[model samples]
Target: MLHRLFILLIAIVGLAACSGGNNFSSGGATDVARSYTLADFSFAAPADLTVSESENYYPFADVVWRGDPRGARVPQIAAMFETAARRSATGLTGDVPVAVQVRLVRFHGVTDRTRYSVGGNYHIVFDMTVRDARTGTVLEPARRVTANLDAPGGSRAVALEQGGQTQKVRVVNFLTEVLLAELS
Candidate 1:
């Protein structure tokens, strides 16, 4: 009876956390994307990502790890970079209201980990490019972006863990914003 009760409790909790939708939609960077689409330029990502999980360690946004059990993954940062590049091309066209296309020229993921004074963590690097959709000209060229995922060094969850996810997401947002600013 105890085992059954435990299973039931876990089921209820998991159901509460599950997302209602299967599709993920990330808005383009407004700063760069005043106008644009994916057909314009080419892109390349980093190599591959391998993420470990911990109850206390979390991402800033509703990011989806390579194999997230929760199924609440957000669009990867590479997509955001490409979107921003498309928007930049739109900006270059003087917001002429033409539909631009972006192509994925390359996509790779590079994983690296580091040990800070506080903890050990990993980051995924993504490299890509964006260009003119119709004319096939390079828009932003190829650039690399990195997203860090940190794991607490200690054994148990600390009070700081409460905001870890929010902070990580904020860092990602800042990175995207900066990239868009530079590309556009």
Candidate 2:
């Protein structure tokens, strides 16, 4: 009976340890730029990982997301921006590529009401630092950037989404464009 109680207590503790934790992943949802955040717009990363240069990382803060779904996550957002950075990297002409260190601050895509009506802005703000891929040298110091774009709305929004220019796609495109201009 005592042995059974001890085993049960161990099992309970193990379960608690596993389920009671949240981890920060290097890659975003689809393995894309790397992650760059949490709910309450707050995120706490797992304590073990160290920020490095060669491995792309986008640190995050308490993100303020309005009109986004509850399922919106930092990993997903980080993945989106990372993917865009990769896309923009293609435009880099030199042998050594550049890295973008982005710390996301705010993002608000079209709300349902705005999407159905006169459209809105995908208000995205972040602090970005550009670095040399080979040397980890800062090409550009951290600068706050606002990468907002017009979100198509009403029938146009729906049509674009149906055609695959979704909120994700548009935002990614906008970010890619932003990075390209910034890098240049």
Candidate 3:
């Protein structure tokens, strides 16, 4: 009998942990930035991920939400950026090879009704480092790329999509642009 009670309690706790305890609305929605600009590298974005709309990550609330406790997307994006950095600026030849390191920290949320469809403000930071592939010399110190997306609606789903891919793309583009500018 005692074992049954313990099992029930464990099940309840597991369920609660899985579901983020936030009442998110699914009515309003908008894309923060369909796309962003950068030099040498450009990529398309679906939407911006609003930190506010993130049920688990409440930047303003002084909370950090590890959507994937294993830390997945951030590393993937960082690897992509590093690969971009290593490629030569030229088409297929005469491009200097380089390497880069990236770190994506927690993001910040602001209130901006005009820019983002998310209807709130979004701010995220990615720290990066660049080095020469051949000489192994440090090319740039860690940089923090920040951007805000439009969240015109008050929907968490919209915000997640935006903040997840769109915002990261912009930041990656921003980093690429900065790197290209320096190289030029």
Measured by lDDT, the strongest candidate is: 2
> What are the RMSDs of all candidates, in order?
13.7, 16.7, 14.8
Model 2: residues with Cα > 4 Å off, grouped in runs: 1-72
Alpha carbon deviation, residue 39, candidate 1 (Å): 9.2
CA-RMSD of model 3: 14.8
TM-score winner between 1 and 3, please give it. 3
Counted clashes in each candidate structure: 29, 3, 17
TM-score of each: 0.36, 0.60, 0.38
TM-score: model 2 vs. ground truth: 0.60
Provide the lDDT at 174 for model 1.
Answer: 41
Ten-residue stretch with the least lDDT total in model 2:
35-44
Better of 1 and 2 by TM-score: 2
Q: Give the C-alpha miss distance for residue 90 in model 2, angstroms.
A: 1.0
lDDT of each: 0.38, 0.55, 0.40
Q: List ranges where model 3 is wrong by over 4 Å.
A: 1-95, 108-118, 154-184
Q: Summing lDDT over every window of 10 consecutive residues in candidate 1, give the lowest-scoring window.
A: 107-116
Q: Sort by lDDT, best first.
A: 2, 3, 1
